[model samples]
Target: MPGLLYLFTLCNLVIGTGAFVLGGVLAPMASALGVSVAAAGQAMTAYALSTAVLAPLVLVLTGRWPRARVLVVSMAVFALGNLICAMADSLPVLLAGRVLMGVGAVFTAVAAGIAVALVEPQRRGRALSLVFIGISMSYVIGLPLGAWLGFRHGWHVPVAVVAGTAALTCGALAMALPRTISAPGASFQGLGDLLRRAEVLWTLSLTLLYFVAIFCVFAYIGPVLQALLPMSTERMSVTLMLFGLSGVVGTVVGGWANDRFGPRRTLTVQLAVLAAMMLLVPLTRGNHALIVLVFVVWGIAGFGMMSPQQSRLAALAPAQAPILLSLNTSMLYIGTALGAAIGGPAALTVGFDRLAWVGVPFALAGWLTLRLGVTKGASWRPA
Candidate 1:
């Protein structure tokens, strides 16, 4: 079980790192491929869009397959996508590679969540959190490593590394995970019925809004740090590490809170904290010490939202756990794309200092949505 969890997490780390490390390499990629930074940005957007569109579809189509087989296949596809990315020299080919990668990532994410849930009902929160740690580690280690590699060896090196990681993850999953099928009646109609529930809609809405708010500020974090701190490359890397470390801590805290307090209340508190931290970000510019403090708080508040939100979604849609979780993941990537699209223009017009201010209302909106759902008799019990 531990081995399965580690492999699953590693899959997430590679996919996430591969998808996001492009942000750091945008200038170099644009120069090499003879495209504008805007075009390279669009390629990233394409990746998210592909993930969002494919996640539910893949989950529904593969609903009957042995979970372990599904996971192995997904990782294999992910490896191939990265291989494509590593070899591609043209803009169109790169975009194609990203699309393939996104599809593989979407499937792996959904399948992993379902596999974790199957491990132990009581330990669901911990299991899911452990898988998501891959994502947090990607933020903490993979992205920084990718950036460093991109700076030293060019953009292709990181993509190649991600491909290698994906291959290793595939092997691990094949060897470790047991073959398991979904319970009877876990079909597409079950997923449709879950989607029709108001509580499920509310939970997903909260997921979407929270991600929008967090990613809005996060999408421009590098640029914001550059503009505000004006740090040497070494110091900037250190700052990134600090932010990632904080995320790991936050994930553990959120998992603990979810298990102790239940998902709804924990998520509500985390979202509120996130809103408060966003509001504080504008005040911390140019003060390196204060900036680090704010980032740690932001990491705690932002990454903290994930476990509770996911646990809530799974509990709410018990009959269609895999599909619902897959949809939630899709919403998350969509939220990332939306936030990036909105924030880029906002940053261009209002500057990075004001980006946090722009995200505050979105966080407040998420809190309100979750709060309203709770008031309307959405039970906290696991589905």
Candidate 2:
């Protein structure tokens, strides 16, 4: 079980790293391939879209398979996808690789979450957060490492590293994870039935809106920092590291808060903090130190929303744990895609300094949806 946890974490690390590393390499990749930066950036959108479209469908289709076999196969697919990415010289091939990786990423997350729940229901919140720490670590360490490699050697180096990691994770899972079948009666119909509930719809809506706000600001963060602060590139990297570190702390804190105070209160407080921070971001211009401080706050508030929101979704349809969790993952990626799509155009129109303002309404909307869910008694209380 410990080995399985480590394998799951490693798989998530590779997937999360691969998913966002392209952002740092977009300009170089575009120039090397003789394409616009916008075209290169589409690789991220493609990956997110594929994840959103495939997560629930794939999980439902393969829900009855042995857990260890499913995990190994998923990691293998991810390894192949990263290998393809490392070898690709054209934008289309790159996008194809990203799409393949997206499917594997979603599958890994769904299977891992189900596994965690099965391991211990009482500790599900902490278990899920531990699995998600891979994502937080990617931002904290993986992206910076990828950026350094891409800048010094070439964009392909980082992709090769991710591919290697994926292969290693596959081997670890195959050797360590226990073979287990799905719970009796767990099927696509269970997922379909869960989705019919109003509470489930509300939870998903909140998930979508919160991600839209978080990703919109995050997607354009580079330009926003450049425009607002007079920091050197190295300084900007350090600031991003601070944000990532704070995000790791925030995820842990959110999980603790969820277990202690319940998901409703934790989510509400986090959303409110996020909205306030976004609104104050523009005011932090002209002071690099202040910008860093604001980023720490933003990271704490923004990332703190993730665990509680996911926990809320899990509680929404407890019977269809795998499918509900998978759909929540899909909503997150869809929100990310939507945020980037809308934020890019908004930045072009209003400038990056105002991008923070653009996220305010979405954050408010997320808060409102969450409040509605709470009012409707969708929140779970431990007895």
Candidate 3:
């Protein structure tokens, strides 16, 4: 199970780097493409919107296919999309490529479903979080590397590298992922039916708000880090690495907390910490050492929320777990899209140094929605 889970982790690592490398490479991408920094950020918005809108359609169309087949094909599509992005000479071409990459979001959703399905119910939380560790690890490895390469050589270098790895991951997933395992896939009507439920709707709202809260800053983190976290060039390198390492630690601890304390309790604490950090991060400007501590804790709380949120939604509708997870992924991306879309312009008005303020309302709304609107148990309101 651990080995198989790590395979899924590697799969996510590639997919995640492809998705997140934009942040590190944003400046050069903007310079090369002849767009504003905010405009360049829309490439992320394009990718997120594509994932938010289309991955579900892919899920519905390929619902009955083998999970292994879906995983393989999705990585292939992801590789193709990034290759297009690397070759793009203009913004329209870039947008089209990102839209294609949107097809890749299914990989993560399906991976999560498989992770939970393969494990004992008691251990699903840990298994699920472990699957996402690759994404956190990307911040440690992929983002920094992508940024450095983009800065020195060209933005296309890192994007082309992402394409190569994704192609390799396709072969690895094809060989490693079991063809015999066929978990339930989501249908269009099945997804619509789940959305009609009040509790499910509210739970998905929680997901949307949670991500909007984080990505407001995260979407522009490279710039925001430069503005807000006052540190020397050497310390800045260490700070970003620490942020990634803490994410791995947070992911591990989040799973344990979910199993030990339940998703609701764990999320309450995580959300509160996340909200506090967003506000606190801006205030720690002059004190570099203190800022690093806050940023480390922030990464822990930020990445830690994923497992618990997925657990809550799964527990909400065990029978519809795949579809629900798919929907949650959509909301997550939608939130990410909203954050990027909002952050790009808002950063101008608020200043990157003070940008965490944008996420505060979202954090508060997510907590309120979770506590007040979502049901404690899996009781769905009648159709």
TM-score of each: 0.92, 0.92, 0.95
Residue pairs with clashing backbones, model 3: none
Off by over 4 Å in 3: 189-193, 229-237, 374-383
Candidate 2 least-lDDT 10 residues: 181-190
Question: CA lDDT of each candidate?
Answer: 0.76, 0.75, 0.84
Sorting all predicted structures by lDDT, with the top scorer first, yields 3, 1, 2
- Model 2, 210-307: lDDT tens digits are 88887776765556777687555466667777877888888788877877888878888888899998988889889888888887888887777767
| Deviating ranges (above 4 Å) for candidate 1 | 1-3, 36-38, 180-186, 377-383
- Please report the TM-score between candidate 2 and the true structure: 0.92
Judging by TM-score, tell me the better candidate of 1 and 3.
3
Candidate No. with top TM-score: 3
**Model 3 collision count:** 0
Collision count for each candidate, in order: 0, 0, 0
Tens-place lDDT digits, model 3, residues 1-117: 557889989989898889988886676789899998889999989999999889988987898898888888988999999999999999999999999999876889888888777
Best by lDDT: 3
Total clashes, candidate 2? 0
